[model samples]
Target: MSTILVTGGTGNLGALVVTRLRDQGHEVRVLSRHSPEFPVDLRDGSGLDAAMAGAEVVVHCASSPRGGDEQAAGHLIRAARRSGTVAHVVYISIVGVDVVPLGYYETKLRVERLLEGSGLGFTILRTTQFHDLVAEVVDRVAKLPVALLPKGVRVQPIAVEEVADRLAELAVAAPAGRVADMGGPEIRTLEEWGRSYLAARGRGRRVVPVPLAGKAYGGFRRGGNLTPSRAVGRTTFAEFLERRG
Candidate 1:
């Protein structure tokens, strides 16, 4: 079994990836500032070299959407080189990241570029929004009298576990550059998703659609966040709701 070093291994997707690697009998090293396996700061690079030593694969799941995602990826790339034995570096990215004008999305694109030029065997997997995020949005809107979402924006949300499973599979296989995009089985607008989520949970929140503008929202409005052609995930939002219930 290969030793895998997972950055951001304590967070939602990263935690799931860690579990997947462990279940497959791989030696998993979790590198996060607060991780129980190995406490390392992705920003400072403290303990990162040690965390990556002898690791056969490094699954980069760490990201800061608010900002600094590119910086974090750069740190990890340097740390991996210091270790001198990492055979592959797998990066998790979002669909349409290059098209999105948001700061976080731009940061992800920079990381992709960094990995491509790192001279390391690397694989980048861009996936759609996760079901957990969709549920969270519904819950946030539930706090208001009416569930409101931006207009003209569609999302293809895959199950977080499914993405984790795919990452694990890639971590163990030969590095393939920029694999096929992974998407949910269906695509729906934000309002449609919010309404269905509330209806599924038997909540009575009225779903309201609000117009969105600006370059940031422009990408989403034009379907930048969707990958209908690659809708490979089996789980649906309704199915996710049923599981949570």
Candidate 2:
């Protein structure tokens, strides 16, 4: 069994990945500021070397859309090289990061490039949005009397558990560089998703499609965020809502 370290082990996806790795008899170390045992922050590389000392694999699941992702990724790459023990670094990225034009997507793409040139064996898996994120958006919009959704935007949201499972698999296997993009089983518009969410919650709200400007929104409208051919995820949005209820 490999000694694996997971950054962001307390997060929605990282937590599950940690559990799966442990269940397979791998020695798992969780590196995060919130972790009691390994309270290392990835932003500044504080205490990172200690956490990564003997790790054979590092699953990078810590990322913030708010910013600082580039700095964190750089720190991680440097630390992994210094450790000289980590053989595989698995990264979770968004599916359309290269085409999406959003600031967060750009940051993710930059991080991917950093890992590619870090001289370390790495695997990058780009996946569609998670069901939890979509649910959160719907919940936020439902708070208002009229639910506002982006016009002509479509989403293919996969389950966080499925993504975690995939990450765990990659952590134990050989580094395959960039893998096929993983997408949800179905692609639906924002209005359809919002209506499904409202119906599942037994709420009656008018779903309004608001036209959003800018290249980012246009990218979304053009389906830059979707991978119709790679719809490998099994759980649909409706099923995700049912399971949560």
Candidate 3:
């Protein structure tokens, strides 16, 4: 069994990755800035070298929406390269980060380029929005009389378990560089997603689509976040809601 280190191990996806790796008999090291158990911060080189030492593979799932995803990723890559012990680095990224102008998405794109240029053996798995994320948004708005959503924005939300399975498989396999993007089994607008969510909850709310300006909304409207041909996930949004109940 190989020694595998997973960043953001306390997160939704990272925790699943750790579980999957351990289930496969690999020694898994959990790392995060906040988790006292691991206590390794990815934003700086602090505690990074120790995390990289003797690890054969590094699965990088650490990220932030408040910005600085690039810095966090770069810190990990630089430390790993300096340690020269890690064989491969796997990054979990979003699907539309390349074309989307949202601050978080832009940061994710920079993280991808940093991995590519680091000259380290790496595989970047670009996935769509997670099912939990969609549910959170819908749930927040469903409590209101009118559900406010971005008009024309669409997303293919996938189960985090499915994404973790794919990431764990990539961690064990030979690094394939930038793999094909993975998405949900269906394409849906945010309006439709919210409507279905409320319907499942037996709640009545007016789904209002607000036309948004800026490249972020434009990218989403143009289907930049979706891989229509690569819908490999088995869990549909409806199924996900049922499971959540």
Candidate 4:
């Protein structure tokens, strides 16, 4: 079995990736910034070499959701390239990061480009927004008597478990460059999803559709951050909610 190194192992997706790899009988190591176990941070080159030592593959799940104008991601990719021990670098990127001109998405897009330019064998898996994200928004919107949702915003929300599975598969194999974008089985609007979630929770909340004004909201409303044609992910929103219960 190969030694798999997962960055951001404490996170929702990274933790799942490490668990799956370990379940498959592979040696799995987690890299974190402050954790005593396998302490490593991609933001800087600190402890990176030690984390990558003797590892067959490095799954780069580490990232800042808050966008920044810096070269931190590039530094990490360069370090991975220099390590020479990593056979495959599986990068988890978001769908339409390139099309959506949002700040966080811009960072993700930059990181994806850095991976491609690193010249290291890499597999980039661009996935849809997590169903958990939708659930979080639904919960917050439920506080209001009428939820203010972006009109015409479409999303194909996939489960984080499915995303972890795909990332693990990519880490175990040879780099495929860029894979087909994966999303949920169904297309939905923000309002529709929020309503369904409220109904599922036996909560009463009306969805008030409003035209998105800002750049981020505009991008979402224009469907720049969603995948419609690609419906490869098996988990649905209803399945996710049921599993949560």
Better of 2 and 3 by lDDT: 2
Q: What is the lDDT of residue 23 in candidate 3?
A: 98
Ten contiguous residues minimizing lDDT sum, candidate 1: 30-39
Instruction: Residues 124-206, candidate 3: write the lDDT tens digits.
Output: 99999999999899888777789999998888999999999999999999888999989999888999999998899888898
Candidate 1 per-residue lDDT, tens place, 111-174, comes to 9999999989999999999999998988997899988889878989999999999999999999
- Local distance difference test scores for all models: 0.90, 0.93, 0.88, 0.83
TM-score of 3: 0.96
Predicted model with the maximum TM-score: 2
Stretches of candidate 1 off by over 4 Å are: none
| Highest lDDT model number | 2
lDDT of 1 at 221: 90
Indicate the residue-level lDDT of 151 in model 2: 85
Q: Flag regions of model 2 displaced more than 4 Å.
A: none
For model 3, the stretches where C-alpha displacement exceeds 4 angstroms are: 34-37
User: Which residue pairs in candidate 3 collide?
Assistant: none
lDDT of 1 at 25: 94
Model 4, poorest ten-residue lDDT window? 66-75
